[model samples]
Target: MEELMFCYQCEQTIGGKGCTKAGNCGKDAEVAALQDLLVYQLKGIGFLGNEILKQGKNIDKEISKFVQDACFSTLTNVNFDPERFVEYLNKSQKIKENLKTLLGNVPANAPECVNYTIPASKDEMLKDAKKAGIMYDQNLDMNIRSLRETLIYGLKGMAAYAHHAHVLGFYDNDVDNFFYKAFASTIDNKLSVDDLFNLIMEFGKVNLKCMELLDKANTQTYGNPVPTPVLITKKKGPFIIVSGHDLKDLHELLIQTEGKGINIYTHGEMLPAHGYPELKRFKHLIGNYGGAWQNQQNEFDNIPGCILMTTNCLQKPRDSYKDRIFTTSIVGWPDVQHIREIDGKKDFTPIINKALELGGFTEDEPEKTILVGFGHNTVLSLADKILDAVKKGQIRHFFLIGGCDGARPGRNYYTEIAQKAPKDTIILTLACGKYRFNKLDFGSIGEFPRLLDVGQCNDSYSAIKIAQGLADALGCGINDLPLSLILSWYEQKAVCILLTLLSLGIKNIYLGPTLPAFISPDVLQVLIDKFNIKPISTADAELKTILG
Candidate 1:
């Protein structure tokens, strides 16, 4: 009865407990171990990097970027290539040793992770990785383990946001510094639940700042998203479908593929790209083609054109179309072609050629329209109208049912909740979870769309701004507003967003389809007692409870 790997970070983890034999996301034991070892190596670098910082020494920005992207690579379904993780491990080894040498002499009480080194043999390295995993120390207190894993998961999510922002030439020292603080804390033996809780909340606030930095990077670099309607039909000719959440990649592809006779369709989280004025300006940039990330397998099956996985949420590619899919940035799958950035730019020649060879659809399909580009700017611009509608009793409530989605059963709660919500209520959503009910015709509430797609999960900041704007207009506290947050989480990104919400003192969030297994009973109770975090019940029941 040995465990292959233990991961409870994502909501769809096996049995609502942990993925032991293999990850539900298609990562096997080997990839999981390598990722564990890679994260452990990053910690060594972080520990010494923090020590060097304490001594007023300077570390290269490359090191910071390395940590960010490496941690990101370990996120759910981002990188499944064991060889890529091995390269990361070897790279961090030199960085860690260089930092220790620079420090000259270190404290005797430094944690073992600070001095940890990768094994020469792959077999031995996998064995050692098991020891570095979440359940390595069985004797560790359940509550402490719970909080520690929670913090680690939040950091993973934080690393994702910071990585995307960093790619856009945006950096926050406070956000970067916390990486060291939180990672080094994983080794400290004396921290209590309260200390970890405080750190977790602090991470939430920093993540908020990170989210804002990314928002600026995106909007300032491109343009504030406008209310745009996009076509969802397949058009004739060569085409490329961009997936994941990296806008820069999409921008580059849009630029390169223009006038190349290839239509560009976005998949999954990239559907929001249609709202960015700069991106959508390309006439060849057609509409979105697929639903959420979980549906990519069937959606991309031997289809025309190619897929570019720029950031994360990559599942195992089926053999039917594996050769046509390319990974860039931190996303990698074994044997798939990886596009590398040279001089801060990626060339899309290979993917473009593959897409061209595929020749796309033989003829144009019928077009259907869906509305996007409803960022905070767009929503708040109509503040007067919304307030007037509210005063006239035209709008009853606001439901912010948003977050990542997965293959977990009972996730239809989000769909049913949106369907069951009163017509007078508006269902605001962001991230891929919106795909559940986004296509359904909810009609319009006067000038506003019934379902507001507020960009990606990274744009959760937009949601926050929208909520605070409404609260301000109504002259009431955020919790007092007629808004409910029923979220369905899948990965670490959702984890950090949840932490961000809780840190703002927001309460009564109904989180499902199941709570994280990493949360001990005691820790869960604390969250319930302090924040009133409720597990989601039936959509109808919860809807009735919220209204009546």
Candidate 2:
């Protein structure tokens, strides 16, 4: 018998509640437990880093990368292969041991290693979990539990962004210290909901700095983005579709396939490639191939191209398309091809050759085109014009209605908000969240499209830049601008983005599609009082509240 595994990381598990038998996520109990162990070990390392920081020692880039990788390994769909999971666990242990040596002290070690040959039964694992970490006390009330989980989840998101930034050679000491502090707090016995709430807001603040760092790295390296149009049709030749959030991998693929006759199409969060000047300059960069990440299974079925996934948001592969999928960076599955460590600038010749072998569409298919490239640079370049229009009452409100999208039924609220919004308003969006309404014909305002896609979730950095620039253009603070942020969050990246918003003291923001399951009432109230945060209501109610 295939031993059952239990998990409940997402909204669409086995039930709306959680996965009790096998993980609705397709993770077995053993893998789930190991992931938890990995998180626990990370918390221990975080504690070590915190101690070192208080002693006035700074963590180096190598240690910071290890910490961030630990957090990322626990993401919903990142690592499912048993061997990879074990490798991740062993690496985390090695890092922890190395950190201990660097600090000249030893902290707590993980529980006894599990016997992989004879898997521990679910009951045994559950019992072992009771002694896991600082946040494991059953006596703690709901408020405390909720607050700790909230911070952990927020950290999980921050770690993901941190990992991506690390990939591009970016690091922040203060951000790294806070990560340790927060992780240590979860294990601290003295923490309260009030304490955790303050920490939650602090998480937001640090995320701002992190996002800003990534923005600088990206724009400085790739040049500021400009407006461009992307096509939605497959060409009748050899091609490759690169998805996910890592631009380094995409840059390498573009370089390797320079004259190989293999066209490259950006998919999922990558569709915004139309914006960046450096990436957009690639003539063979071609256009987009499909819709949001969720629909990729069907889109890839019988598709004649090689697909390179560089990060999260991968679904189970179909047999027809399995052999064609290639993953790099930390993204991995049990039986898929994974490319590790670039041998001098990442030769994507393997992926390019696969594309040529598969060919592509038999005929030049009619394509659907959409306008993109609305990053901070593009928006700031038009700031004077936008401000002039706003002053003339030509442009009234700005709605930042963007976030992650799941199979949740309540997500229609975004569509309604966009449709019911005032005619003079602009809808700025990023990430998978925009899929709810990106196809809508909101018409253009002056020379700009009514609905603008800045980039992926990390590109929320672009939205922040545009907001701050607009504020400066109008000689006001961001909060004083005619902008209302209605954000929908479904995963860790959303959590980190929310933290960045709060960190900036940008208040009166509305968040929803259902608030996080990890926040207790006391913790939630703290956020409400400090940030004026509120759960999203119906379009009629929220619009009245924001516009009335």
- Top-scoring candidate (lDDT): 1
lDDT of 2 by residue, 1-548 (tens): 53244444454555444465556555666667666766777777777777788788778778778778867767776666666666766676676666677778544452232111212344454445434532445597878777776678788778878887887888888887888898888777687666777888888888888888888778887887777888877777898999888887888889888987888999887877667889988999999887777788999997888899888778878899999998887787778888788553565767777888998777788777777888887888888888888998888889998888776678889999999988888889888888778777899788767898888787898899899999988889999999999988767888778877887889999988876655656667877998899888899998887789
Candidate 1 per-residue C-alpha lDDT over 90-186 given as tens digits, one digit per residue, 9 for 90 to 100: 8888878877898889779887878888877778888889767988887999998888888888988888888888888999888888887788777
Off-target runs (Cα >4 Å) in candidate 2 are 1-17, 107-136, 342-345
* TM-score list, all predictions: 0.98, 0.91
Name every residue pair that clashes in candidate 2: 5-29, 204-499, 205-503
State each model's CA lDDT, in order: 0.89, 0.77
RMSD per candidate (Å) reads 1.2, 3.6
Total backbone clashes of candidate 1, pairs 3 or more residues apart or in separate chains: 0
lDDT score of residue 40 within candidate 2: 71
